[model samples]
Structures are given as C-alpha cells and as structure tokens.
Target: MRFDIITLFPEMFAPFLASGVTRRAYASDQVAVRLWNPRDYAQGNYRRVDDRPFGGGPGMVMLVEPLQACLDAIRADRAEDPATQVPLVLFSPIGKTLDHPAVEQWAQSPGAVLLCGRYEGIDQRFIDTHVDAQISLGDFVLSGGEIAALALLDAVTRLQPGVLNDAGSHQLDSFNPSLDGLLDCPHYTRPEVWQGQEVPPVLMSGHHAQIERWRRDQSLQITARHRPELLAKARAAGRLDRKDEAVLAKIADGL
Candidate 1:
C-alpha cells in the first residue's frame, strides 16, 4: 500500500520512516510512503501556504490553492483511475477517533492521501471539496496534524506482515479481537524474582492451560479496573463466556 503525506514539515518524517521496527515495512515497500510539501506548490516569493482567515481568526488557515495543486500532482503521479482514486484523509478534531479497527482496515487498503493541517486549520472549502475522510486521535488538540499522521502511519505499518519480529504479537495487543477486545495481560521477563516479587507460579509451571488461564484472569482484572466500558462492550457483544464472567464477577466482589 502507498500513502502520500502532504505536510509543511516533511523533514519531520525522515527519521521516523527510517527508524523503528515498522521501518521494515517502509524499507521493503510493504507500506510505501511519499512525502509532499505544499509549500513547494505555493505561488509566492516566500512560497507561503497559510493566510489570515476571512472571519478574522487568531491563527492562519492553510490555503486551498497550494493544497489543491499538491493533490493534483499526487493524482498524476499515482495515475490511478478517477473511479478508483484513493481516499483523501484529513486529520481534524471533528473526525472519527482512530482506533485498532480503523488501523486494520487501512493496513489492507490500497492506501490514501493524508493531509496534515497546520496553524488554525485548513480552509473549510478545501476540506469539503477534496477530503474523502477525516480521523482524529482524541479530544485533545495538537499544534499540527503531523504527529497524528505519524501515529496513524506507524499503527498501520506495524500491522503489515513481517513488520514485527513476532507474527502473532499484534494479535495479542490491546483492543484486538483475538483477545476479545481486552487489554493484554501483564508480562514478566527473565528473572523469576524481581526485587522481592516472584513471577507467578503458573507462568513457570510449564503448563500451557494453567498459564493461559492465569493470563486471562489478569487481563480480565486489569480491564475491569482500568476500562470497565470495554468489558461492558465485550459482554454486550456476547464475547464474554462463562469463564470470563466468572473472572469479572470475582473482580467485582473484590476477590
């Protein structure tokens, strides 16, 4: 899959694309990434891309003209049929919050054009005309959409085959369906005893069933304590079986 990122600070992505475990995905072209700077397409002595908002805002708004020109160049380079043109995604406060499912979907897609807005925001006209989708990290705001874009790319890239050393690692990640959308259990490594605490006996028992049961119990407890809403969702979806309910019941009873 290919992602064309339109940003004013393309340099910010250079190190990110080259570093991390997900770099394997980029290096092997499994998740092809191309950065485009809208400033390059801006028409001015200073090549400005932002301007004062018409309604008199505190911050400047990204110009639609430069962004449109950049998108045009990208479309020509992609050379895809108009009917099959990839979605243009903008990171914004009003968009759907990104999550595991969204990342999974993007991982399997043909990829998209990611528009990273700067200053106050992009011109509303440009967003309405060109953007096909919008995604938000959360309720909070950022200086620019660059960080959000990086987050999305990293999440999607890591899900590509061979990106992680362990093929099944992500399957056990928090919010994955394999774990029934539960946060992962605590993990201990190396020393059986750390400081004064010893690794749980089940973990060292060489009994897979007992170990898995212990992990399930821990996962249920942690989720109930930290994110009870997820447990509620899992229960609503009928993903919590008898054994799972038993664990949750014990947690509720303070056992």
Candidate 2:
C-alpha cells in the first residue's frame, strides 16, 4: 500500500515513519509513504501558503491555489483511475471520528492521500473538489493536522499485512472481535509472581484449552467491571458468540 501525505510541515513525519511497526512495514516493502509540502506549490518570494480570510477571520485561511496545484500534481503522478480509487482525507474536528472500523477500512484500501490542514483551515472549494473524506481523531481540536495525520497513519499502517511481528497481537487488542469487543485480559511476564501477588493459578496450569477459556472469561469480567458499554455494543451487533455469552454469564454469576 502507498500513502501520500500533503502537509505544510513534512518534517513532522520523519520520526514517525522511521520507528515502530510503521517503520518495519516500510522497510519490508509492505507499505510506502511519501510527503508533499503545499508550500512548495506556492509562488512569490515568501512562498506563502496561507492568507487572511476575505471577510476577515481570526486565523488565516489556507489558500486554494497552492493546495489545488499540489493535489493536481499528485494526481498527475499517480495517473488517477476511477476503478482503483484512493481516498483523499482532510483531518478536521468537524468530520466523522476516526475509529477501529475506519482504520480497518483504510488498511484494506490500495492507499490514501491525507491533507494535513494548518492555520485556520483549508478553503472549502479545494476540499470539496479533491477530498474524498474528512476524518477527526476525536471531538477536540488540534493546532494543525500534522499530529492527527501521524496518528492516523500509524494506526492504519500497523494493521496492514506483515506490519505486526505476531499475527495475533493486534487481533487481541481491545475492541477487536477476538475478545468479543472487550478489553484484553491482563498480561504477565516470567516472574509469575508480581511485587506481592502471584500469577493466577489458571495461568500457571498446563491446560491450553482451559487457559484460553480463562482468558475469555477474564476479558468479559474486566469489560463488565470497567466498560459494560462495550459489552452492550457487542451484544447489539451480535458479535458475542455463544461461548462469549457463557463467559459473560459466569462473570455475572461471580459478581
């Protein structure tokens, strides 16, 4: 997969693309990333990209000309094809919140072009003409889209094939269906015994099937104690299988 990131601050992406699972993914040729600076498309001595709002607003609005030119150049390079669509996303607080499902969808796509808006925001005309979607990290706003871009890229790229060292690692993450939409059960290390507490007896047992059952039970138990809303959603979506229901039943009984 390939990701083209359009931003005013291309330098911000260097550390992100060079470390962790994303870096490994890029090194293995499982993924590709390129950054484009909108300022490069700007004309004049200052190479200015933003301008004061026409009617006068608090912060300067991003100029459409430079952004449009930059996007056009990108399309030209890719030789845009309708059948093989690539999503062009603009990060903004007004858009749909970024979540697991959205990340999953992006991981399956051929690639995406992300617009990292700065200053006040990009002109609506440029966004309307080129952007395929607008994604928000959460309800809060950020100074610029650079941080959000890095976040989204990291999140989606880690889910791509070969990105994870262990196949089952990300699968077991909270919100993943493998745990029936519950947060993962607690993890343990070689010590077996902690500061004062010993590992659960079930974990120390040599019964693989029973260990798996215990993990599932603990997942549901922890979810019920900390985030019953997650279990409720899973139930509504029919994500909880019969075995998961059994685990929940046992958890409830103990409570």
Candidate 3:
C-alpha cells in the first residue's frame, strides 16, 4: 500500500514512519509512505503557502494554488488520469468520524492521499475541488491534522498481510469478527503469577477448548463492562448465536 501525505509540516510524520512496527513494515517493503510538502510547490521569493483569509479569520488558510500544484504533480507521477477513482482525504473536524471499520476499509484501497490542513485550515475551494472525503479522528479539536494523519496511517499499515510476523495478531484485535467485535480478552505471559495475581488456571491446563471458552467468557465480561455498546450492536445485527447469548448472560449475571 502507498500513502502520500500533503502537509506544510511533513516532518511531523517522520517519527512514526521511522520507528516501531510501521518502520519495520516499511523496511520489509510491506508498505510505502511518502510526504509532500505544499511549500515546495510555492512560487515567488517568499514561497508562502498561507495567506490572510478574504473574510479575515483568526489564522491564515493554506493557499489553494500551491496545494493544487502539489497534488497535480503527485498524481502525474503516479500516472493517475482524470478518470481514475479518487480517494484523497482531507482531515477536518466536521467530517465523518473514523473507527476500526473505517481503517479496515482504507487498508483495502490501492493507495491514498492524505491532506493535513494547518493553521486555521486549508482553503475551502481546494477541498471542494479535490477531496474525495473528509475524515475526523474523533470529536476533538486539534491545532492541525498531522497527528490524525499519522494515527490513520498506523492503523491501516498494521493491517497489511505481512506487516506483522504473526498474521493472527491483527486478526484478534478488539473489533475483529472472530471475537464477535468484543474487546480482546485478557492476555498473560510466562510468569504463572505476577505481583499477586495468578495466571488463570484454564490457560495453563493445555486444554484448547476450555481455554477458548474461558477467553470468550473473558471477552464478554470485558465488553459488557467497558463497551456494552459493542455487544448491543452485535445483538442488533443478529450475529450473536445461542452460545454468544449464553456467554453474555453469564457476564451480565456476574456484573
């Protein structure tokens, strides 16, 4: 997968792309990430990418001409024609909220162009003409979109098939279908006892079926306590079978 980010502060993405598992993915050629700075496209002596808004806003809005030039150059390099399917996204507070399902969908796309608006934001005309979607990380306000863009990239990159040594690792994340969209069950390491808490005996019993049952039960309990909405949504979707209902019932009983 390829990710091209358009931003004035492209340096902000350096840490995530050069460190941790995502960096390993890049090193293994499992994914590609590139940053494009709009300022590079600016013409004239100042090479300014922002200007005072016509209506006079508190912060300068990113100028559209430079952004359009940058994006056009990027598309040209990729051999993308005018008729190509578009998936360029602009990060904005007013856009649709992003979630695990959204990340999954993006991971399946051939590639993406992420526009990280700065200062007050990008020019509205640029977004109207080029953006295919506007996505928000959540219902919070931030100074700029750089952080959100990194979060999005990390979420999708980890889903690539060879990104993780254990393919099943990403598969068992909180929203995975195998876990019925419940939060993951507790995980224990080598220590039989930690601090004062003992590893659940069922995990050490070497009984796969019993361990599976215990995990399912623990998942139900965790979801019921921390995210009942997930269970409710699962029930509403009619994805909960009798066994699932039984597990949830036991969870509710204990609560």
Candidate 1: global Cα-lDDT?
0.93
lDDT of 1 by residue, 165-209 (tens): 999999999999998999999999888888999988888899999
Comparing 1 with 2 on lDDT, the higher-scoring candidate is 1
Arranged by lDDT, best first: 1, 3, 2
- CA error at residue 55 for candidate 2, angstroms: 2.3
lDDT of each: 0.93, 0.85, 0.86
lDDT of 2 by residue, 1-255 (tens): 888889888988888878876698877657788789988999999988998988986999999989988888887887888677687999998889987777888888888888999888889889888888999989898989989988888887778777788877899998776766788998887888778888888888999999988888778889999999999998998987898898788778888
lDDT of 2 at 203: 85
lDDT string, candidate 3, 156-220, tens digits: 88898877778889878998877777899999997898899999999999999999888887888
- Could you tell me the TM-score of candidate 3? 0.94
Question: What does each candidate score in C-alpha RMSD?
Answer: 0.9, 2.1, 1.5
Q: Which stretches of candidate 2 lie over 4 Å from their true place?
A: 241-255
Which pairs clash in the backbone of model 1? Answer: none
Residue 41 of model 1, lDDT score:
99
Model 2 TM-score, 2 decimals:
0.91
